[model samples]
Target: MSNDRREPATDADERTMLEGWLDYHRQTLAHKCAGLTDAQLRTASVAPSTLSLMGLVRHMAEVERSWFRRVLVGEDAPPIYYSDADPDGEFRLTEADTWAEAYATWQAEIDTARRHAADLALDDPSTGRHRRTGEVFSLRWILTHMIEEYARHNGHADLLRECLDGATGE
Candidate 1:
């Protein structure tokens, strides 16, 4: 007989449920990026399009870190991908770096974001005033925003990865 050891789902398992969904999405992004070389991951398929597997990874890293650490936690510092002079620097790859470095950088950002989220209650308020609009929101809103941001980018990553080398799926 085949073995199945999955835990039974319970109605009270809200935390586990949220985490499972979050993990599934994160894994999908990672799977889309699997088995890609540095050049393949970094290459731009069409002119004037900044979308690439590596660029998406970097972009998501910036998103996660910016929302969870900088905005939610109210860090008095610049965002990882934001520069006053060049706002598009996150999508622009100006250097030829190793694949390992790219993946490691992404992983590091993901880890930090996860740790920060785990430590905070979702209802926790943002520490600083928003620059764009004068509004206040809880960390819960930030996390949900991150999920939506990732979902959109992951879809783009799916197409970009397929175009890079015919790879497909989450």
Candidate 2:
């Protein structure tokens, strides 16, 4: 697979191009999460931050579900990470017993997010309110947010993974 990260042109087909960028980032994050031991997956290498590979996988799962299902669709869906419970629950993975389980969760969330993005018309704006602050946002804004969030997190993952092992991005 090519390591180059330049997104496909947006002018060709805006929706496809946007989705491609999102999918590329999702894959990049997964690539960083792959090939690790249980201990390494759970290790908090970034001091004071409990951001492990497993935790990031869980967090991404919540992010995909919450954004694609709840926010974009405006469904009366329960928040994936927190629902008046604990805010930090997204990063907390008590049941990430095995690496396989964690990866499966991440993959399932990714599939759902992809389907949600595919089902939308690029011109149609999303109609969900932000969980906090009660602010409403459009699909374009959400997609851009997701792309930015993943890009930033993937950069962090690059350094974290490199420190965990000598591996760098392809």
Candidate 3:
């Protein structure tokens, strides 16, 4: 049988459950990205939009920092790679940007996300409010949202990796 990216367990609590799913999704993205050359990863054969695996890596790192550090922690967390002038900059790559660096940043951001998340209970509310709705989100909402974000992007990573080297898997 194929190895499950997500951890399997029946008796896990809420936080553990969310963490497991999120980690699984994160690892899935990394697995899809394994062994790709920088140029191959930069290929946006998916077309008009530049959503390469490298872009996804950088984007997810930004997402984690924004949610966990900015929204949840209420710290002055800003975009790490992308900015107002070039929001899609993460996907815009050159020969210099290595997959190794992107993956390293992604893992570091994941660790930071976990570190920040562990200090709070699922029921705890955000230290900051939502920008659009002006509402404070519960930790439960953030966990679920993060999982959803990774789930969607990981699907894209699957397709991108497949196009890159004919490699595919769950």
Candidate 4:
């Protein structure tokens, strides 16, 4: 099939535009790991940080699960990649945590997020509480926050990919 990165369409409505950009950022992260081996994906090429391509994949999967399944859909979905004991577990991958599993889980989370967001209104409130303040949020806020989150992490992924092998672009 086609190996093209999807650019967010500018002419769409607010919700559609948000989804498009979010999807674009998601695909952009995957693009950074294109043609790389699992070791390459797991390598913390940028020293002094625990960031890696594989870790990003896993982290974003958890992010998708948290916002869409747990918050937006009101499903009470539990954490997937991290725990209370090790909150950054998603960023720490062992040899056993292969890239295949990371990518598959990330894709599955993305699929689930899309399905959950499909029928929901932007003004809907989430079922989850804020970690620091015990506050609820709207679906609009979740979508906006997710886009910002992906954008930030994708920036890290961009640098990590560059340090690993110089691959770039969304």
Candidate 5:
């Protein structure tokens, strides 16, 4: 996906606006990593920081699964990357982690998330409760939160890509 982000329609309804911006940010992350080799994808931003393009992909996959499948759909979905023993496992790359696998997983999670939210109303409350607050969130809240999550991470991706190859843009 190139950095040709779709401008969210200013006159669109709330749902369309949220989904549009979310997809824009999603594509932004992918565009940042495009044309990079596995080694480049795994290259960390700086010493003592495990953040990398590949790690962001894996982390987003987990985030998608957690919010859409586990929380929205109320599925007993488990973490695909991290665990209780290593809460940041997605960011902690291993020799076994491959770009192909992480990319596929991230795409799959995005697809699943779209499906889960496609038929739900914005005010529909999630079946699952927040892990910390024990409060159920509406679909609207989840969508807004997901947008914020992607936008924040995409900023990091922007800098990482620039550092990696001197490439920079919205």
Candidate 6:
């Protein structure tokens, strides 16, 4: 309940609302991981599940890079974690993985994403196509999808944090 996340404005314009909600969710994820030790950040939620706060941060970095840099801006950015050989590479933490690195990478990706989308119209089509459908997406669609993605993962983060400690909030 000690979160610093800003609630999205209910009376804002469409673009404002979307960006605000996305940022709110982003801050929510950060809040969930704050004040945790390295071990706590890397600790898996439960047996047979490798989902951890650190992993989520890494995974989100890859996601932000993929959607914004690779798709939206047509950059040749590659995945930072997962690949064909290991699709869940981000989630499979190694001894070398550190919260500092993961958080930095995630923050960098967020910054890049904001920069790439800053002046683009929401209706503008992405330069890249979906890997499966070969269909191009609009910035609006991508933004909405990102909001959904973060919302889902933030729920998992909520559970993870609760398990790690006793913290819970909206």
Worst 10 residues of 6 by lDDT: 1-10
Tens-digit lDDT track for model 3 on 1-103? 1444657476898778888888888888888877777887888865688889888999999888878887888888777788789977888888898888888
The lDDT of model 1 is 0.70
Error of 6 at 50 (Å): 0.6
lDDT (10s digit) by residue, model 5, range 61-86: 99999999988878899899999999
Q: What's model 2's overall lDDT?
A: 0.74
- The residue ranges of model 2 lying beyond 4 angstroms of the native Cα positions read 1-11, 80-83, 94-96
Whole-model Cα lDDT per candidate? 0.70, 0.74, 0.84, 0.84, 0.92, 0.92
Which regions of candidate 6 fall more than 4 Å away from where they truly are? Answer: none
The all-Cα superposition gives candidate 6 an RMSD in Å to the true structure of: 1.0
Worst 10 residues of 2 by lDDT: 1-10
Q: Write the per-residue lDDT of candidate 2 for residues 1-170, one digit (tens) a residue.
A: 23545666757576667777887888888788677787777777657887777777777788887787777777775655555578777565554466787688778877877777676776566677667777766667777888898888888788778889878864
Q: Which stretches of candidate 4 lie over 4 Å from their true place?
A: 1-3
lDDT of 6: 0.92
How do the predictions measure up, each by TM-score? Answer: 0.83, 0.84, 0.92, 0.91, 0.96, 0.97
What digit string (tens of lDDT, one per residue) describes model 4 on residues 30-138?
8888888999899985567788989989999998988788767668777888899999999887888898899999999999998888887888877777656777888
Per residue, candidate 6 scores C-alpha lDDT tens digits across 44-100 of 999899999999999999999989988887788878999999999999987789999
TM-score of 1: 0.83
Residue runs of model 5 more than 4 Å from their true location after superposition = none
Give per-residue lDDT, candidate 6, residue 91: 97
Better of 4 and 5 by lDDT: 5
TM-score of candidate 4 versus the correct structure, residues matched by position: 0.91
